[model samples]
Target chain A: MELVVSQLLTGLSIASILMLVALGLAVIYGVTGVINLAHGEFVMLGAYCAWFLQTEFGLGLIASLVPIFIVLALFGWIIEALVIRHLYNRPLDTILATWGIGVMAQQAVRLMAGGELRYVEMPAALSSSVNIFGATESAYRLFILGLALSLFALTWYIYRHTAFGLKLRAITQNRDIASSFGINSGRVYRATFAYGAGIAGLAGALVSPLKSVSPEMGTTYVVDAFMVVVLGGTQSLFGTVASSGILGELSGFLAFHSNDTIAKALVLLAIVILIRFRPQGLFAARVRT
Target chain B: MNLTGKSAQQTLLYGAFCVAILLVPLFLDDAFLLNKYSRYLVFAMLAVALSLSWGYAGILNLGQATTFGLGSYCMAMALKLGTVPVHTGSDGLPDFMVWNNVTELPWFWAPFHSMAFALMAGILVPAAFAALLGWFMFRGRITGVYAAIITLAAMVVVNLVIIDQQRFTGGFNGITDLAQFEVAGLAFDAYSSSTYYLVAFCLSAVLLLSLAITRSKTGMILQAIRDQEDRVRFFGYDVALYKIFVFAVSAGIAGLAGMLYTIVMEFASPTFLGVPLSLSVVIWVAVGGRQSLLGAAIGALIVTGVQGALSESETFLESWMLIMGGLFVLVVLFLPKGIAGAFEMLAALFLRRSAAKVPSVSQPAGEAITHGEGAS
Candidate 1:
């Protein structure tokens, strides 16, 4: 029972990180209809930014979140304005374009930081494990789990209730109609994209301490993020949350039974089968075509 | 008569291309350059396969490398079986397997001992896999980005499996120290002029066969489907069948290329099945005119050539990746049709001028759309 609890906690922590990464992807994809292949590069950029701040400026990872988010979000906005904005009508081109952008970003980082893995120092307070339900668990993992769930709640609240969410939804439904209603669809799109990018930046900053910070680190995470986005209906925030938990736990459970690579292969095979059966994913999005 | 007149420019260009490919050995007699050029043709074959599926049929398979790697491994296994034990003294089980402590050869590796079976299996396996993938994806109407993602994820799984199952598949090092290619009494040595000719012959034959297919009625239907799939489906054509056919043909071509790659390079590794290689094929196809078979082939040759040349230079090595990325972006941004498209435009202009010189032109510009895609 204790082992199961610990495994669940581990899975939840993994799900939390996945949630952070996929949230931004889901946000951008839902609103703008652009599947950003460069999303992983943005995550990598965020990790680098966090690493730079923590090492050069001696800032704590906890202290670097807001600034990193703001910076990367603005950068994402600029990218949206420059490239993604033009390719809105062409979905296939968006994949190719973002792929180019991802490649450029990856190479740029490699040139600057070099390919060596950089480490982020975890905060002293959360480094140690604490007893929970008669099982030892890392405090950092618990904190991350809490952070992930709360962020999901916060995102859900903002998306479902706020005025910005209203405008975003209106534009997503019908661009011309939304514009006629005095909502600047362009600005709304840019903002939504930036917000999504910001959330991705937050994901990178948080995950930096847990994993090795390298230029290619984001690629691994992005694949998982994409799976989450696909498995969770693209337009649904709640679906993203639910799918992340399910996939995270599935991989965690499998990994516990087998080796890591085998577990991943199994999870991927499961996803392939799931997608074959239900391409719309686990939850259907309630949207007007 | 109308077809002959329309394809006059195309016929001339194709003849020149064939001559150019055939004459490379005469211009560069160095054995090293001959081998490199042969490898370029292999890459072009991959690009052509990609164009058939992605450009003509509009099915972007992101896991093309999976089929390619599988094919190469098949050929490698067969060739590995031909040779007796190097150090094993354990009755010919492949050096890596012997190293991994396998005394007896596995059943799966038994059939590859026959050259003909290995060759057939190389093409058949990838084609069958593609057909299965197509049945699931196309039949279910899972087109566009979802199809691409599924293929990509599937490939990653295959890559991990190969790497993880090292004892059977040679793990990360892959099947190395491969035996020389021999059939009956003929030895297709990598550095030999005959080997280069063999590759050239294969490349040319595949190119011609592909051209014939793309020019046929089915090819027209595939392109029509690419433009407006729903319209084609509404017209009572089985969209899934056409897609599956083109996808399988594409996979077969890629598998053929992979087999050639193994023969030329003398090894097959997990990286052959990697996402990066798959993406590079996309890049090559996109950069060459995705819709043009010849363009895609040329694009692969140029891109691979440039990469090889740049990576070797001291000053350009570090910036090579940046240049490639920049080229990819610029092509996507301004030149979506690619360099081949530009060449086509120039050819069209020349044809237009020539037509003006002789006023009695029977065929109208309506056939230009069909014949114009022939090549530059």
Candidate 2:
């Protein structure tokens, strides 16, 4: 019972991170119809921002999060305007273009940061452990979980209740019709892409303390986040949450029994098999074309 | 095969290319330079393989390195067994296996003891895997970005599994200190002129064979499918079968290249299956012009040669990736047809200018040129 309880908690913590990383990908892809392969680089840039701020200006991770988000969002906005705007209709080309952006970003970071592993100190307030139902848990982990859920709630409210989201939805449904209805789809897409990038930056800043900070670190996170988004169904936000939870638990349980690398391989295999059977994904929203 | 003027020009190009490759050793006396060129030849084969599926069939396989790595490992395992007693010991197990406390040779490594078996497995295994994967993906109707993501995911899975199974696969350090490739009684040293000739010969054969495939009737149908899949299906073509066949064929070529890569490099590492290498292959093909087999091959050679030269300098080494990245972006945006496409455009312009002097002679030729452009 104790093992199961602890395992569940661990799974939730993992799920929170997955959710945070994937939320931006889900938003950008769902709305813009661009894969944004540079999404991972955005995460890497966010982590670098946190490291730079903490070391250079004595800013804490928590304090630097907002600035990191803004910086990444602005960067994303410029990329979209310069590159993605031209290739919106060509999905495959966008993948290649964004990948080029990602490679450039990674190399730029390597040149700037000297290719060494940089560390960020965890916040002192969340450094302690908390007793939860007889299983000791890191307060930081719980905080991440809380923050993830609140972010998801905030996103949902904005998506479902806001006028801007209504325009976004209209554009998603039919770009021609949305424009006829006076919605500036290009502007909405830029904003959506930027927002997604900002969230991804936040995820990177948050995850830096848990994992080592390096230019290559984003590659793993991006792949993992892609799996979560792909498995959850491309268009469903709630699906992203549920699928992340499922994958996190599965990986945590497998890692417990075996090891990290093996667990990762197994989880990838499972996702591949699952997608083979259900290509539309676990929670595909029913919509008529 | 069609004795058209364009076809004649293409044939002349191929012949010139073959002669240039064969005559390299006569011009360059340095063994080290010859070996480097040999490696570049292998990369050219890989680019040609990618061009077959990505350029012709419109299947962008992001995991091209997965097949290449598999083939390399298969060949490496055989060579590892043939290494000197100092590395493998009298028992014939690889040194890493002994280090990992693996007392016996794994079952998979058993067949690789024979050079013939390893060579065949190098090509066949990756081809078989690609056939199965292509079948699965095409049957499911997974196209575009989904296919790219799945293949990328598969590559990562394979990479992780190989790294995790340290005892059998040598983990991160990989299989090293491989013996020279020997067939019958002749040994092919890595830096020898003989090895260079072997690579050049194989590359020419692959290039010619691929050109033949691209010109065949089936090739026409494949191009039709690439342009309009639904229309081709409507015309009674088995779209999935065609995709699988081309994908498998491409993988087989990549596997052959991988074996040659192992021969040239003298070792195999997990980096062979890494994302960066795989992505780099796509960049090479795209930069060369994915629609032209020879163009793509030449693109790989030029890019790789430039990279090697640039890596010699300290500042260039630091910013080579950034430059490549910028090149990739500029190529995709402004030069989507690549260098080959640009060359074709220039040739067409010259032809049109000469034809303008005699309007009657240019009519049918102009139509032909436009027809070829439309097909691409």
Worst 10 residues of 1 chain B by lDDT: B367-376
lDDT of each: 0.85, 0.89
Give lDDT tens digits, candidate 2, residues B1-376.
1358788789789879988999999988888998999999999999999999988988889899999999999999999988875755577888898889999888889988899999999999999989988877887777778888778878988898899899999999989999999998999999988899999999999999989998998898888777777788899989989999999999999999999999999999999999888888999999999999999999999999999999999999999989999899888887877889889778767877786765555457757743543433
Q: What are the interface RMSDs of all the models? A: 4.1, 2.6
* Best of the candidates, TM-score: 2
Each model's DockQ score: 0.46, 0.53
Candidate 2 stretches greater than 4 Å from native: B1-3, B87-89, B357-376
Candidate 2 Cα lDDT to native = 0.89
- What is the TM-score of chain A, computed separately for every candidate? 0.97, 0.98
**Candidate 1 per-residue C-alpha lDDT over B1-376 given as tens digits, one digit per residue, 9 for 90 to 100:** 2677756756566567767888778777788888998998899999999999998988888788989998999998998888777877757778888788887888899998899999999999989988887888888777877788777877887888999988889999998888898877899989867778878888887887888888899999999888778889999999999999999999999999999999999999999998778878989989999988889989999999988888888767887767777788778777878888889777667777787766535346636643433211
Clashes of 1: 1
Give one digit per residue, the lDDT tens place, for model 1 in A1-289: 8998889877888888889899999889988988888899899999999999987999998889899999999989998988888777667777888887888888899989998999988878899998878788888888788887888888888888999989888888899999999999999889988988888888888888899999887767778888898889787888999999998898888889997788888887777667768878788676667
